[model samples]
Target: MGAIESAAQAAAWLLAALTRELGLFAAIGLAVGGLDDLAVDGLWIGRSLWRRATVYRRHARMTMATLPPPEEPGAIAIFIGAWSESAVIGAMLRAALAGIRHGDYRIYVGTYPNDPETERAVLGVGDARIRRVGGVLPGPTTKAECLNRIWQSMLADERASGRRFKAIVLHDAEDVIHPHELDLYDRMIERFDLVQIPVLPLLANESRWAWTISATYADEFAESHQKSLVLREAVGAAVPSAGVGCAIQRAMMARIAEQGGGLPFSADSLTEDYELGLRVRAMGGRSAFIAMPVAPGKGLVAVRAHFPETIEAAVRQKTRWIIGIALAGWDRLRWDGGVTERWMRLRDRRAPIAALVLAVAYGALLLSIVCRIAGIRPDWPDALEPILTLTGALLVWRLAMRALFVTKAYGWREGLCAIPRVFIANIIEIAAAWRAVLHYVPGTTPIWDKTRHRFPERVGE
Candidate 1:
């Protein structure tokens, strides 16, 4: 009788443990479901508002008509990446041509060490205004290093010539530019120390892969450029910079140079553009986002970056970004400031917690499944049914909202289809978060992950 009672007690304890695990799994699933709904809905609403508020066509015309002339001849400095045949590059060249034809801006192309193909391409244009500069410093062979070297070289040249630039613009090789992009820059230079215009993605009729890349970029840019920046400005928060389509003042560049020519940022962060913006904010400098007016023939610019033809390449590129931005740079986000700073801090803080919770929930779900397979009974109370239903509803609503926003930014078909992909991506992102945590434990130099480009042969050529 004593042995039988002991065995019964053991069974009860096992049952209790199994019950707890099942409950935890249910709760977590509900929570994640709710978050998904919230993210989608919020993003959709925010994007829609941004689109309606900024009337691009009228703004562009107004800007062109009233803006002052270029501060001086060769006052504008343009930085172009030299590699590959990207749609973004084409757009940038078009913009450079426009600047040469209309604005009195001096264009400079900052490129890798002696690429004959790039040289041939640039020379083919027969434009004397565009000058190419090689030998970017630090010799790391990364974009950040290349950019820093270019900035330093440009500054040294300016100082030697006793001519200071009024404005500086960075362009990727894949960008498409409108004729009036420079005019927009001219007007904005009058007000803001740093100004950024919309960086749209190219829309093409061929290749679903192209469409996918373009649409994804469109969604991302719409959120970051239009909604987030506007909101940050309204709340007096530091507006983070995008990688390209950025223009800065000469005085700001000089100040950054004083800080040791480190790409205008204090730290060697993966998201260098964002870090630069934060540094600018820390120094009491202001930045603004300019609305790109879309008219019949007046779209500002579009880039075709990484139209990955294969799933493997897409995954590799995304993983590199994840490791760089989410994993390596997590700790570098500055949280000690005012109210805006506090909000940013909170956002960064919660991301890791969310990832952990997801991991825990997944673990619990696996435990629950295993216990059930082993004939262990779960003793969850029936009273929790209502709570579980409410949680699940919230989750579905959140996902629906995100889907709606994606649809508005891209299209319903692609956006809705991407929901599952987004969830999978979040799981991968969580892995990145864990990797970041491991990196912070000891002596770890940030690993530079390089993405290989796929330059497919042009169709019908």
Candidate 2:
């Protein structure tokens, strides 16, 4: 075919994909919103309360039975990224102390040489159990690289001491972990090589910014960590790793490092957690997801990372994540070979179709808004109703499941408030994914877009 003819065909295909995606989105919005309303109403009226109550009961029983045995002792290594402020570092130190008190665990904190506050905070823990390493490490200043250096040091220490760690847990500086998180780690050590805990965002009751951060993250974990991980596990699909609240065995970590250390910490990918998860799975390891326990009132653990507190900061962080995960890691994970290599390869190839569809859907919505404002109706055919309906129903089911999980993990008030944020988050994510795609040029060094923490005013000085 002539170049002009080929171009015409490509344009036609793109348009068709966009049209189909828009119909899907509209249907999804309507169905999910409607079902959510129905669920709320039903819960208020008491018909679905039985099911909800039963679920609650089962969860309660599990929590009660899953307490860690006192005899089962394990060491935990916590990695807080470079550039943490004092308040954030302080919170981490407190949690580290708690972790030490709870187990026969030694705390190994990995940080940069220049972070004096982090170093001081490690000392502040005042426990001989805590040790700091890699004060000065080479290579990219990304989280992955920091972790790699720490892991290498840990391996050396273990070899010298002739002892192996039972678990290695990653944590952010702002994390305020529930005491029971250590217990959960102990209980689950026997069943899975790696255990990932759902991370809950701690929002200050008075801060609107906190509310936004809480809702967005809560909804995300609800869907991705809770439901999606469960679904993926059932179907043998590759699961993405959350950066923190995750624990891996020494044996598994060693195995992954032996396999080319997968991708080194670099500026190329912003999502070190996702990349690590992919590499681990690629190396024939198994991972399990445990719901963040709610008994401690705030669940097993919650992270109180300081969000942008302003719109620009939030947008920058979200944009970086979007570009990194959707653009960089998406390609890397899709292409990475492993036990589920073929399946992942196929999923990665088809995943972009969803992003392209979303982009088109947004464009159509903009056009529709414009048309409505101008008193013009762009006619869509009646024949697409069933397709639209099915698409909407599926989306509603997905979101409904997400909302249910969120409500259970947090509370109804938080879950309900998070609905709008969930939509906004998805749009941000889609935009990030597309942005990453456009910038996927060759020879791009991974950029570590560092997030600034709002240290307590006293610490800030």
Candidate 3:
């Protein structure tokens, strides 16, 4: 009986210590991260409203002038690197062949020699516009390396045909290309060296859990593509490439290749596309993030693809992103830009800290429940109350903005679902952050962490 009492007392003391320490840590993290998020929210809202009132109102012609389909659109070279993507490559190529309205473009699909299944699928597409570029290396090389081989293939083709590609577009094997995507790229690429269109994840109607997990991506991307990237570009910040639905000037690609020692994409980096856009901006190349409708009644010319619908897959995908942007990216890309650009970089690298805060916050919540069941109430500290309240308010504002943007992109039902989906997103992010730390800290070889993809039956509809 005495040992049982002693054990219970020790557990209570341990719980109290964990609760206090975690609360203090969480408070500091929340104060910093919350304020940063609040600043971005203010900037997005204030800048958007100001532009609508002044710049947009001053030039009615700006809103009125619509770009017509180009009669002589320049030839575009599309690069798609595939390893074990046999499942969706054929469907994606077929959709792109049928859907794209532009006449002057060729797709260079890079395939590994060992990945015969994927190679066979690309060959099975049997379109003249699709050129299958055999990989020099075996299967499972980095995505950047694969893309570089495709670039080499394009260069060889240019040499053989005596035709120069006007622009180079990058895409994954699972993407559902928009019909007017090339048109938008053709019109915009003439002005901006890099043109990035919005990317929206297609929501899968599977099991309830699957639907919720997939909706988390929809909520995040809807808010991010509509609000975050728009604001980043509006504030004169360099827009990072989404690696899909983006076009870069062929000249700029050549310059980038020359600077990077004959490779336009970095073979050593995981997020080569993200770095490519920043590098272009650093080299005085103009970049733009466009979210405009192709026609009055038609939807915006955005790339649509299915994101990971399972927690494990989502974690694996996000783990690569966290490592590339937050960990490895910091070492590769310098923080050398304007105030807004630096701020955006900080936001990009805040994933680990955000994950830590989230874990501590959840831990505190669980401990509080344990204390309550044990009839142990924590001593309320008055000093931390204001900070906690402010952070709580900021969190509410963040969620409200997420819902607003999601509702604008999706419907009100998804907007409401976005509220609870925050928790789901947080869980996946925390897991990814942990995995990224483990994977990156040990200095393991970074390979292409490819996620399995699915193509919707009604693609390009």
Candidate 4:
């Protein structure tokens, strides 16, 4: 009985000490990050209200139908970088060819020489507009390298046909193209050097909707497209390309290529699409993020695709993103921009830190639960009360905002799911951050850490 009492006291003391440290750390980090998020939320809300009152009051609200069509549609080239994507490339091409309501555009599918199955699938599409550009390098090269091959092909085709493309669009083989996507690009590319539409994850079947990991992407993209990117664009910050549903003017593409010695996308960067968007802004190119609906009460004209549904797949994909944006991106694109740009960059690079805080926060919560169950009272610091209270309130606010945006994009069902999915997302983020640290610390060349992609059975519906 004495030993048991001593053990309980020791455990209680350890819990008390660890809880104070972790709880304090978590509280401070959450407060700082929560304030940052609150600022963004305020900016987004204020800007949106201002626009609705001022701009919409004066002019008719702009929807897809309201946007003026290009008087003379210029040639647009859609580039899809495929490395061992034989399974979905054919379906995606078919969907794009059937869906896109444009006349003067060509599809450039870049496939590695080693990935002949994908190249064959591209050719098998049998559409005259679909052109297969075989990469000089073999499979598993950087996506930027594959895209560069497609760029060269576009240049060669322009020279051969005596027709130049007005804009170049980037997409993945798994993307479901919108019918009026090219129309939006053709109209917007004339005014802006770069234009990005929203990307919504497609929950094609009931299974996909039920998959927690898959549903998380829907919540994430919905909120990001509706709020974060919108806020970024409103503040004139560099809008990062989502790798799909984004178009860059041919002139801007040429400028980027010239600046990078004939490669528009950087081969050195893992997240070349993201880097391309920022580089465009750095080069004084105008960019816009458009999230308009096709009609007054219709769905958004956005790129839709199936995201990784399994935890392992999701972790692998997110690990790549964390390594690229949060780790290597800092080394490549050092802090250089206006205040808004720097603020956005900080948000982008906060993933590792955020993950750490989240981990510690969860650990502390678990410890508190154990203390209660074991009847071990840990005398927490008096100072922690206010901080933890504030943190709790901010967390509720953050979850509410997440649910609000997600509900606005999706429906009430997903909105409710978004609350619990916050925990899932935090776990995945922590796992990905740890994996990213391991992968990035070795100083090895970053290859295409591509995950297996799924195409919707019936896309562009």
Backbone Cα, N, C clashes tallied per candidate: 23, 5, 0, 0
Q: For candidate 3, write residues 260-344 as lDDT tens digits.
A: 8999998877889899888998999999988887555557789999899999999999999999899988888869998989999
Please write out the lDDT profile of model 2 over residues 247-351, one tens digit for every residue: 776677667666654423343467877666666666677777777544554344434343454444555666566556555555565565544445444443433
Q: In candidate 1, what are the lDDT values of residues 1-461, reduced to their tens digit? A: 99998997797677667657657665755566466435534654676566567765345443444546555434578776564333233335654575344456666665554455565566556676677666633223455555666677777777798977777877666544445666666666667777777665434446765455434444555445545566666567666667677777778766876775445543354556766666667778788877654354443333334334334444554554544444444556536579766665455345455667667666666766876776766666675666567776885665565565456555687567555545554565466556555544322443334343432233111
- The TM-score values for the models, in the order shown, are 0.72, 0.75, 0.95, 0.96
Task: Report every candidate's CA lDDT.
Answer: 0.58, 0.60, 0.88, 0.89
Which ranking of candidates, highest lDDT first? 4, 3, 2, 1
Candidates, ranked, TM-score: 4, 3, 2, 1
Q: Which stretches of candidate 1 lie over 4 Å from their true place?
A: 1-74, 81-102, 114-126, 136-140, 202-218, 261-267, 296-304, 307-330, 348-353, 359-394, 418-420, 431-448, 454-461
Give one digit per residue, the lDDT tens place, for model 4 in 1-461.
99998997887898877877887889989999998999999998999899998998999767888898886689999999998899999999998888888888899988887888888889899999999988667779889888998999899999998989999999999999999999999999998999999999976355643478888888889889999999888898999999999999998999999988998988867899999889999999988999889999899889999888778888999999998899998888989899999999999999999999999999988887887887766767788889888888899999999999889888988899899998888888999999998889545567898999988887653
Q: Model 4: how far is 416 from its true place, Å?
A: 1.4
* Root-mean-square deviation (CA) per prediction: 5.9, 7.5, 2.0, 1.7
Could you tell which candidate, 3 or 4, scores higher by TM-score? 4
Clashes of 3: 0
Clashing pairs for predicted structure model 2, backbone only: 27-392, 113-135, 267-446, 267-447, 268-446
